[model samples]
Target: MHASREPASRSVVSDVVADCLADIDRIAREYLLEVQKIDDYAGSAVVAQDLEETAVASMELLLRLVGNLPIPDRLAGVSEALGHRRAQQGLPLESLLRAVRMDFRILWTAMLEKVPAEFLPDFTQDAVRVWEAVEFHTIRVHAGYLNELATMAQEKETQRAFLLSRLINSEGKDPQLLGQAARALGVKPESSFIVAVAAGHAQKAFRAGVLRAGVGQFLHERDGALILILEDVPARARREPEGTRAWLAALDCFVAPPARSLAAVPPMLRIALESLPVVTPDRPGQRTVRDAWGYVAATRLGEYGTVLADTVLGPLATISAHERDRLIDTVQAYLRSGSVSETAAELYCHRNTVLNRLARFEQLTSFDPANPQDAATVIAALHVHFLRR
Candidate 1:
């Protein structure tokens, strides 16, 4: 009796599927009209076509699944195709899923209307099977959409990296090519921009911080360092002081002065590179071209500055190294503080001890910290001395 009833159920299911297929076209049209009213698909012919095709394909899959036919290959192909098309159109996955659910609703409602009352009980169970097929189809679609989006993101990154490399290296000499590269990098060729170079380990965090602060756009990486091109850096600096400092502290960052044009980038980068070695190790965070200018000048002067430093601090050099270091430290503290008491406080020493060191320095160098002219000379000599070291 069970075996006899199996054929009867199969025959009834087949009839229901055939009826559904016969009305598939009408059902698809109604689905399309309803979906067109949705904002995501409104007035979009390509999206309309995609929706119509998806509805037709879904109905066909439902027919085959209900008829108990093996159509996994067809189901997979249609699902992936729908996902790939939607991803290419830059439509959100949620939108695609919403459309898929709508299709299921239309198809299921049509099937219920066409199925005979005698088979409604059986068809209700078959509806579960239909839902399972929809689940499988949706899984494949999601996978395809994610895969396509990944590929697209990778391609865009590759193009962006290439353009950034060309821009940094000044490979595109012509204005037209430079403009194209700048546009690809999402920067204006004529805009004033600053470039910051950061160490490899800190690059990712530094870039994230800059982006998070919304100060400017980070273009790309070059030579194990991250290169950031910032627009209106001075304004951003003023607006986001705390955020700017946070990222700057995370990086061994060197910033160039504003470049007037894309053509000026290479030279500006060179200047920033030249300024790197002159950055004092004690100053680890962001160093601008202006901040490092004194050291840069000392470095450029090289032997001349070294000789001047030696001659100016010659008396101190004659003393024991320890004593010389102490006296020099005292002078630096005094110069920085501009007062013996403040210098003593900073060095964690007695005021008399600081005063004594200052007296000794004045006696050895014949330059008084109290005298502006002599103090200027001592400061210049100290800068050169540090730069030389």
Candidate 2:
């Protein structure tokens, strides 16, 4: 069976594989047996007959490729179906690759078995064509597998987002919709949750940050704001809403403190968004109602806030910037400490200096920072000025 040393022609290699076609059944059975050892394939639902058929077809495809014969049109669909089916079965891609690559080993072994030894190395040079065939099937298989995976993920996300919309928009009014969404989204009804909101412009950054931080679940844009619902599972301490807010603050988000039940999200979302106007660099990290109460009240007061700001604090705008800041700083410190001596201590100035600044503030605003009745108006006015800025 010895032959010339000149490299084997394409037709010679094709003949060797074509000869093995009679034994393709045995080669396919061996292919199936080998794949069963792979854990993912062993657990998958792909039937033995189907895999054997794919093995046989793949070998035939290699035969045609090496022979330079036209591949049957249907051969393309066979590989595509193989990849898609394995993907649908949830078999890990490595299993399919391992199984697909076997075509080369089994078919090459068959070809070598039938070729003359003197020409074996020359014939072995054609192994690259066998690999080309393997790669052909591999690329189509990869495409089909990846396409199916993308399709599945997109469909699941679309459905999840839709269900979540119903849950939040209906404000959990529909018990059935709430239950369905909760189940799909892995939210528990009895658990406490935090709903954080950011302006629509911050949606993309906020969402990416939330994902990277792993601090929450379920981000969606609703009613001109982007919101995320974080489940407060006690077992996972990091999921605490307050802790989440501390990190989420870096994302320019306002997070409502944890409240019982997902049903209460709509009202909490309102509270979350209400603080956005007050979230300046000086007043950043304000989340709940208590965090920014004055601003919240000012926002609720509507035009009255404007009127209060103009009547009570507008005169300060005309004063020298340094004097105005000194007076405002003394007044705010006095309000926080409730003692002239403590305000002076907090401001690192003598009692007379504090008194003089307070006097100047009274002359400008006509409200005593120490008087409870006047202090309330002054506080409201400051909130208006802060928010209006």
Candidate 3:
């Protein structure tokens, strides 16, 4: 009877050990799996905390089951592994602590099915302290990782702003160099652009993705000051205009309260060159290259200058309106003939009146009324004056 009892006692010990290992393993694996699920879930930080609880509970049960076997160095390995994994993330320590407590509670509950009830509580409390230390270290590592990432993000933003500023300000700079610089900043160039410079009140008009540059009062010189390049759109029907009035209106449209003036690039290159010198007086020697855009700029400037000059002086000419009209008609008619009747009829005056108007016109414009060459000069002057206004 004594021999039989010894063998039965050994079997019981073997069965309990095997059951404790299987239970601990099943709990650890379930907790680990749950932690992974939480990592992918919405509000994963909270889930991560729950997972820590489950792990702590599993560890607690493992300790209780192996209590009589003595504490092994392998328990420390569990803490080390937890530290390494937690070091890779930025989760808060409080969440980990809560998860550790939850894991231990679960382990105690499961172990109670086989473990003597009285022993369960003491086992759990003992293992809880060890898990608490591991959780504390995990939180520290996560916070450090997060701080490093934030610093890196701020540095990148500062660098991007600096490079973009350089790209916008470097005029006549190499295209290849600009493209490379933009690439570094991840800015893509929009092809076929017009560079604009807005000044005054327009300076505050904020638009996302729109670059800003300086500009002056005159449309031509505006570009030389501050310039921002952007894509261009073809004029629509409502936006299109014809004749001098249309041209003047367009100019005014660009000259808003914020902007003293605005000029289209390439099409207004000549004006830009003249204005650029004045606009960028600090750099006086940078205007040698001229191509299609320059020609357009020159033409635009010439048109604008002609309009301005006419606006200031056109109404103040020496010849009166009535006299100038009569003069032109008489001159053209006289050049067409020496016939007095034809000249008088064309002027809507009597023959003698036509002669008198002719004399007065010649005196005023310094042209010989009867001479063909002098008559031609009067005609040319009259045409130019009419067009000027």
Candidate 4:
């Protein structure tokens, strides 16, 4: 009686396995249709194939496990492979797992239909085994997905850095290579772009703000500054002075005018770098060379502006730095006010003190503040001097 029952049990399991295999094609189709209804699986033929194979392989594994046969190595391999494929296809892991759960539900429902009520207890136990195998397969697939995500993130960062370097330093780089880099960075080679150099410490915050504002931008850190290339950036996207003063209070930003091509970026970046010293802390954001004649002069003169400052302000050099700053401040106030009383009022000093400072400045520089011609030259020299300082 025991031998006869053993054969009968084996036959029942074999018939169950046969029924599962027969439903494999229909189950796969159903799974695909359900997934498609949730989201378009277009351009994902490879992913679909892997998922289908995984479904078929899962059923086979269930058959073998219930039959007391050895599990195939290909089962684990296919599970991991499907996970990696889904990850590469940029499918959300949750969605992938949900689809897997759906496949299991479909297979389990079919298995219930094939087993008789008398054998329902045994069949339910075998179904539990199949569910356990599904869970195990999910673990392997999830591990593979995580690993692929990490690797893909690393590769993307590496590519970003490489492309940024090419864009920042275009010397000897072929036009073709520059175009490729531009495309990778998501900017057209011929598109008008603005290059900005900002304080490196503010890079992450600045980038977050730019992206949040929906501006297309690429950024890289170089020499303690963050260099950014903004593609067709809207006027409103440019950092506003009041906003910068209120929020990114410590940052210094220099923006260049729109450039016609990627090749123009380095020159524009150079102008921004040269204009850095002219940017005052009080005027914290986004200074353009075109906004001020003084900025343009300072950028054009480069280090020569420092030499010019030294030559023009040489007479004041002999004085103590403290007295020098005081005299310079008075000169600035006098130039801005154009009247001794106004200058004194602005400085909260007596009018005699303003007059005396002006006299002393004239004696040191031989450019009298009282005369229009002399005042013009002195004011221009002061701009260059203070800009460099």
TM-scores of the candidates in the order shown:
0.72, 0.75, 0.29, 0.70
Error of 4 at 60 (Å): 3.5
Off by over 4 Å in 1: 1-6, 18-27, 43-51, 72-75, 171-174, 185-208, 211-220, 233-252, 258-285, 294-317, 334-389
Residue 6 displacement (Å), model 2: 7.4
Clash pairs, candidate 1, are: none
lDDT of 2 by residue, 155-224 (tens): 8878887887677567566778767877767777666777878744466777788888776456765556
Query: In lDDT terms, how accurate is model 4?
Result: 0.69
**Ranking of candidates on lDDT, top first:** 2, 1, 4, 3
In candidate 1, what are the lDDT values of residues 186-276, reduced to their tens digit? 7667655666776444566667777787864454666665677665433223342221344565567787876766667777776777777
Candidate 4: tens digits of C-alpha lDDT, residues 206-285? 67665565652466666677777776532345442221122223346667666656677667777777666545555666
Q: After superposition, how far is residue 263 of candidate 3 from its true place, in Å?
A: 18
Q: Where in model 2 is the C-alpha error above 4 Å?
A: 1-8, 20-26, 45-53, 77-81, 113-122, 183-186, 197-228, 234-251, 282-287, 306-330, 345-349, 352-374
The predicted structure with the larger TM-score, 1 or 4, is 1
Q: How far off is model 4, as Cα RMSD?
A: 6.2
- What tens-digit string does per-residue lDDT give for candidate 3 at 148-258? 556655676556545544544454245664565445434334223333333322333411113222222112213224333333322332332221112222121121111
lDDT of 3 at 12: 43
Cα TM-score of candidate 3: 0.29
Report lDDT (Cα) of residue 374, candidate 1: 86
